[model samples]
Target chain A: MSEFQPKIVAFVCNWCTYAGADLTGTSRIKYSPNVRIVRFPCTGRIDYMLLTKAFASGADGIIVSGCHPNDCHYTSGNFYARRRWIVFKKLCDFMGIDTRRIVFSWVSAAEGSKWADIVNTTNEEIIKLGPYDSYHKLSTQDILE
Target chain B: MEEIKKIARELLAENKVQVVLGFEKGTANKVRPAFFTKAEDIDKLIYNEACIHNIALYLKKDTCQHAKGVAITATPNVVRSILQLSAENQITEEKIHIIGITHEGKCAGILDFKAAEEFSKTQPKGLKPEDKALIEKIQAMSLEERFDYWVEAFSPCIKCYACRASCPMCYCGKCNVETNNPQWIPVASHKYGNVEWHMMRAMHLAGRCINCGECNRSCPVDIPLNILSYMLSDFVLDEFDSEAGLNSVFTSALSAYTVVDKENFIK
Candidate 1:
């Protein structure tokens, strides 16, 4: 049998991290192929509920990437996202969600290499964290109609 | 008790408020929320330790909303709810009157928005020392233990929504769990489904839950979900230095941010 392959989901902002990943492709910077990318207009648009939903949808790990502070195309989107992250991380930790499997980062449009590094390191870390069946099982569990 | 009754009577007699929201004798010595439209009905208006229910939730109901003015028996928790509601633009100060009741069961008389702020600051927050110790005990556990603990804690939820209904802050016309389009959460009350429901509730109530514990009180299964909100409220204060219920102008930490907001977690 083959080794376990973790299913990773990368929720990225259109302006920064998406462009940065694009630059990674153009620059021939290679990273793990385990991740599936979902794009949003800004980090502020990414709801914390989506993070929980990702776990339920069979994702072993998640990467939430956005523009760096003072660099958001929309001025205050990243700022709001940052404040939200503080509370979200605490609640996730308290609720027993393996926050270690979720990665948050600042990847600018110019930081393609940094994006690649984030993906590679997060891939290695998630592989070690193994499957998220604890949360994933909730979705697949039989729901009475 | 007579002081509150007299106050309610005066408010009704002077046409200061169309409805006086207080408590009346329920079955078997229990107290139930009672609305007094007539000045004479103030005789039945009662306030005591048994009147622990957060009656502030009625301020949003049709009876209170349609009234020309509302005078509510505001506990510290209810006052916090009212201030938080006003901050969210759910209620206006001019339409509602707060008859402040101290946590000790003494009436502080009628208070406006300004006086309510002082009353809230002086009152004890709802977190008990035992609950604080429980929070500490849970925080010390391993990540997997914490998860299993919550899963076990929320396993018995019937999703009766007593928690949401009792919560004055949970005034949304349609809760996310009820959204069937994407079906953000399941409506069923299965074990893990209840866990997901609680996680969503905790996150949504993060900075705004004034630690009222009404949700825990209203839960038929006795799920201690209120502790989760109390923990998040402390974290919100420590991280953002912002809290709810004190000021009408201040936004919750979740809804607002400064350029210098801390982000040591994000790489």
Candidate 2:
């Protein structure tokens, strides 16, 4: 009867966003509980398949966060990731997927406040969008039936 | 084209090469690739203005293993496709021979391994007038509009996989689309499946496609499938200034990296 809380999958780069989330914990920063953080070495390591996988696994929103430009641990990893994300965003748009469900952000290892703010803002946006109905339709529930 | 066939037959009769790969007339004037194993079969090999399909797709098949060498009718895109395949280890340089053809239907010459290597390097200076016009047209559109335009153009796809089947660079035995354990793509021909099929194929070929136009030519529904692949290939070429099928020396665009590559999209 009531609105459902959206599930958010946040793929945070281990060297930057994950550390920033750690810092957020240490700083006692408050944020939405909707997001589940999955860490990667760098955003460049995130496969386009994994983004779709998260949605297929019932995440209403997905966030891919990494170090700010000129701050990648692998020097050019974020640059490669940036170029790939541009194509991925365009592909998502063309697929008729709601682009707002997938968010790309740069949260530095020191940006604990920014990480908390991003999580809260993204969570609020997802809540308004409701459950990811399109992705859910591709779930195992349909396969089982 | 007739002169080229006569020379091919002579070479095969002399046992200079074991196989001659060329086009034969097909239904509705479509040119389908024909393999000539015996010198007598060489009479069937034909080429004309309509020989557009990249016949390189058949060189790596199981049937080609017994052949001493492959002789293909070459266009610029066909040459480019071969170079890319050789570089990727799909076929060896020594296993193939190229018979280059001018647009005017003359056999430029038979380019063996060594000559093919040099020919790719001698890529003509300055962009073709058609390429310049295409680039200008593409550049005039907004990114969102371009995305929308491609989606409409790709709507005719039927998931036949003919495009994938005919591509030289698409040599994987177990393609991503066919994986079933955790199916990467739907098996049906819905709009979502069709769009995803094209997008996934285009993405996989981002840095590898050589603008051969084989995928577009092979499409049954006449989708401008090459535009997506060509756009990505152009992006990779401009960003890294690397040519995909020209030589084996340069690292693939997606596989290798530079510390100075652009990162404007990252916040």
Candidate 3:
């Protein structure tokens, strides 16, 4: 049997990681094609539940990237996102969810190479972890459908 | 106990309280939510070990409008829940009266915030082992897996709203799900609608739920509604080290913030 290829969902800020990804494309930097990016106005707008939805949709890994701290377009959106992620991360840890499956990163619009590196590194980590069959097992029947 | 019944009867007879929202025996010796509006109905009020419903949730309903104030049996969790409800403006602090019972079956008096906080301190921590287990099970799932798990858990919901009706915190006259202008959730009973409704309800209760476990117990489909509330409650507790119902002066978790609050992932 062939090994499963993990699906990764990258939720990137429109002003930052999204532009960085565009830069990655413009520069023709080669990286694993595992991630499907979803652009949000800011990381603050990304409800933690969206991460859950991605996993429910069978994504093996999630990357939430936005501007660096104190660099939010909305002055403090990233600050709020950071606080929420702390609690969400603690919750994931307490529940024993594989922490590697979820990554929190800061990628500016100018950081195209950084975006490629993140994708490649996260893809390699998740691929080594194997296909997220445990996710399929955990997702409810209705959500899986 | 007979003493509780006697006091309830006197309160009704003398009109000291307009109503006593206590427990009456169900058809087969079970306990159900009861309203003791008249002296005669006082005899029907029972305070046994099986009395579990919070009854505080009913304080804001139209059915309670006629009453001058409410008097109800209180478990420790009920005290916390009532305080949280009062803090949230679901019910005014003065409109309801409390009749607390000790673990040894002795009745106590109405508690103000000061009294409740003091009383709460005397009572040991309320988080039970089962609460931790339920939370751990939820926390263990990946984000998508958690969503799928909740969708399945809420699949059996028949839109009874027994959970909302039973929750002390769910007293919005125009609930987001019930409103039509900007309907946040559909009013159907399908798995998707039910899951969305429950998820929204849990999120709304985020920091306000006192974990009375009444919603789950009241659900006809036996969905573990407490697990949903506990998931958010655990987050509120661990991150903020804050307890709901402890202070009426402050805002809830999502509503209030600190300048130094964590925001490591925002852009």
Candidate 4:
């Protein structure tokens, strides 16, 4: 029997985590190959609906990373995004979504090692949690109809 | 009820307001939203426990917009919605005259926006014990169990959007669900669509929901939809120390962020 490998989606800000991931590649940093990264101009641009769509698209886990606090290129986009995540995380937990599968982190363009670490650790955690069948079931049911 | 009618009569006869939005006895023993335009029709106004509909929503209607001013029969939550709406600039304070109703079923008489704000502040701003208990019970369930519970609760949704229509705060001219150029949310009422719609509704109302329970009350399927928004409201209060509808000039927690905002979850 083959060992299960999870499909992960990473929503990263182009100014930070996306550049950090690029740095990771250039630096020859080893990380999990399971993640598929989606770049947005800023974390503030990543809509909450996109996160759910990732799950609906068969992602076993998600990584949402952006600039550190007080470090956004737009001065306050990350701050606004942080506030959004706080409320969004609570809503997800209250609605019984497996919020554990969604990771929130700060990885700047200088933090190549941190970007690799987030992806590798999130991949392992999602592998242990198995397939995200619950959300997938919802998406497949829509197709069946 | 008579006091409400008397005030409605004076407000109309004096030309202080061109219309009075209140509740009246509907067919089938239901008290539904009623709009009184003439002093003679004021007697049709009714106020009771069954007068739970939030008539503040009518103030945004095209007919209500044409009125010189509107006098609305406002419960505590309805008054709160009015304050929140004023803060959002959706409605002007000068255009609304509130007839407040106490929790004890007494008429508080006609109040201007300032008095209405004070009235809402004086009212208890906590979840009802029953709603708190139900939320705690749901929180005690395992993740899989809670997911299944919501899926079952949402399965019966027919996408009528009576919840959105009835919400006083959901006064958007173009709702995200109605936008199809990019189709932010699916139009169908399938499992995913239902959950997304409800989540969007709850999120949009997070700090703004006044816990009027109108959404849940209006749901044809009896889906306890208000609990989600109420829980988010509670979350905003506890985490940000900001409460909606307390002041008409206050900033929303989601729209306004500070350098010192709490964020332990970020790495």
Candidate 5:
């Protein structure tokens, strides 16, 4: 049987996780190649709606990583993002979204290995969950007519 | 009902307020929002369990905005919405007078914002048992089952937006959904679009929703929409220990955060 390669999307902050992912590349770290990264100025800039858009656009899994608490380049952007994710994660779970498919983590500029680990772990988890056909079918269906 | 009408009449007769916003019997045994401009029109006022509409939403309307002052019949949730609105600087204490009603069908009399705040303190808060039960039931489902449940529930949405229109907190002049220049949310009633719309609605109202349940009551599809906000409200209470409309002094959960705020889930 063929192996399943899950499609993953990573919404990362430019100041931390993005730089960390960049460091992962420069440091010769091998991680899952399945993830497509989208960089924003800060984690707070990553809207919850955009996360839904990622799923709608066929992403089987999502990784939202940013600076650690009090480490936001914008001072408190990650702190605010943390609170948002806290509520958003609960909301998603309550609405029946496979929140395990969405990973939240802290990947500082120095944590290239941590970034790689998160990617590999999220990729492995998503692969086990298989294709996100339920959401995929929902996003593609024509309900406006 | 007589007490409410008498107060409305006195408010207009004494020139205390230019209008009194309350509810009246609609054509189909339903209670409809009524605006009383004349002292005689106060006779149309009705206060019953069926008069559950949160009339504070009208305070944002242009007609109400231009009025010199307004006297509003406020249920517990309406009082909370008013307090939240006042805290948000949408309304002022002198501009509107509150006519509070108890859950037991009694009048609490004309109250200033201060008195209303005190009155609201005594009112019971949090989700009703039925709502909590439904939330727990959904929470008990498997992820796949939950997804299908919401899909089936939200699929019938026609993008009518009656929920948003009925919501008191959704008073933004230009909602995110209306900004077509960037087209933030899809205008279609499709499944994905509906889910995004509802999620955004709930997120936007997370800490601010007064648990008025108007959004759910107003949905033409019977989509149990209030459960989302109720869940978020409970989260705000448990995680932040903050309740909306409790007093106007505290910052909303999303707007302000402390260093001590709990975020154990983040690595």
Candidate 6:
């Protein structure tokens, strides 16, 4: 059959990665078409549950990007987001979730090319990882008899 | 045991506290939570190692909330919970009295919040040996194996919510599971719903669970829910150097942050 194309969900903050992706489009920087972006007010606004929801909804990969440290528009939102992701990432790892499929990054609005690079590289990695079939089987199924 | 009863009697006799939350003999020699309001009723009060239940959860109940003054027989776990709750502003120091029981099951007498904080810190915080073994086993599995492991582990859940009810930290009036507007969590106890409920529960309690193991004790299916929270708390401590139930001024690591937090994983 044809090559596998993973469905990647990108959760980006309005002030940074979303704008960065917009810049990528404006600058005509071509990246993988595999990613779908979801914008939030701030990195702090991107509830960690959304990440799980993405996975449970058959997303093969996820990108959570926000402002760099000291660069958040709301001052400390990214900082708080950073602390949360550290523990959240650890818990996901401990729970046997394929944390490798989830990418956490900082993409300032100026980093248009950087956002494209992130999308492309993450797409390649997830292509190698293949579909998140195991997770899909577990969460989407109704129940065991 | 008499020391606790005597203290309870004195507190009741002097009208110091409206109720003393402790344990009493139950049917089949089991110890159950018993609240004493009368001085003479203090005769039923008891304290033993079997009293591992985190009685701190009672503070939020109507019995304690409506009372002018309250005292609780606090094991190490209960003391930590009391401190954590106070730090979260769920309750105040002046309203609740802590009858401290150390890790050794000895009554340390009534302690103020300051002493309770110290008592919590000094108590042993290691995971039970069996729990440690299971954690290690889960950690050793490949990612797929771990996912399957949890699926199987949660398969027997009946959605009884005993874990949330027994946990002192899960004090939300209407849990997210109850919100059907968007249906954040599935209401059914099926495999998928069970996993989602537990993941939601774990994240909510990430920086808050005090390693009390009451959730496990309360689970009818005996799912290893406690180990999940324990692992999360251990990581929170190792990475953030903050712990729950250690201080009354409770800002969990997740709720606050340093600009310099480790983020090597962020690409």
Better of 5 and 6 by DockQ: 6
C-alpha displacement of B110 in model 5, angstroms?
1.8
Better of 1 and 4 by TM-score: 1
DockQ category of candidate 1: medium
**Tens-digit lDDT string for candidate 5 (B1-267):** 788888889989999999899988899889899888999888778889998888899999988999999999998989999999988889988889899998776899998888888988998877889999999999899988888898889989999999999999999998999988766678888888888888899999999999989989888889999999999999889998988897856578998777777766676
DockQ for the candidates, in order: 0.75, 0.24, 0.15, 0.74, 0.67, 0.78
> Per-prediction TM-score, please?
0.97, 0.81, 0.73, 0.95, 0.94, 0.97
Model 4 vs. true fold: TM: 0.95
- The i-RMS of every model, in angstroms, reads 1.5, 5.0, 5.5, 1.2, 1.3, 1.2
If chain B of candidate 2 is superposed on the true chain B, what is its TM-score?
Answer: 0.86
Worst 10 residues of 2 chain B by lDDT: B123-132
Estimate, for each residue in B162-244, the C-alpha lDDT of model 6 and write its tens digit: 99999999898898989998888888788888888898889889889999899998999989999999999988888889889
TM-score winner between 3 and 4, please give it: 4
Reference contact recovery of candidate 4:
0.75
**Candidate 6, which CAPRI tier?**
medium
The CA lDDT at B81 in model 4 is 85
Query: Residues A18-121, candidate 4, lDDT per residue (tens digit)?
Result: 99999999999999999999999999998898899889889999999999988998999998898899999999998899999999999999999999999988
| Candidate 4, residue B101: lDDT | 91
Indicate the residue-level lDDT of B101 in model 2.
Answer: 73
Model 4, range B1-39, lDDT digits (tens) per residue?
788888889989999899999888889998888888999
Task: Tell me the TM-score that candidate 1 gets on chain A alone.
Answer: 0.95
Best by DockQ: 6
Model 6 chain B: ten consecutive residues of lowest lDDT: B255-264
Residue by residue across A1-145, what tens digits does model 5's lDDT show? 2299898999999999999999999999999899999999999899998889889889999999999888999999987888899999989988888888899999999999999999998998898899998888877865434
Candidate 3, after superposition: displacement of residue A47 in Å?
2.3
Off by over 4 Å in 4: A142-145
Error of 5 at B242 (Å): 1.1
What TM-score between 0 and 1 does chain B of candidate 3 receive?
0.88
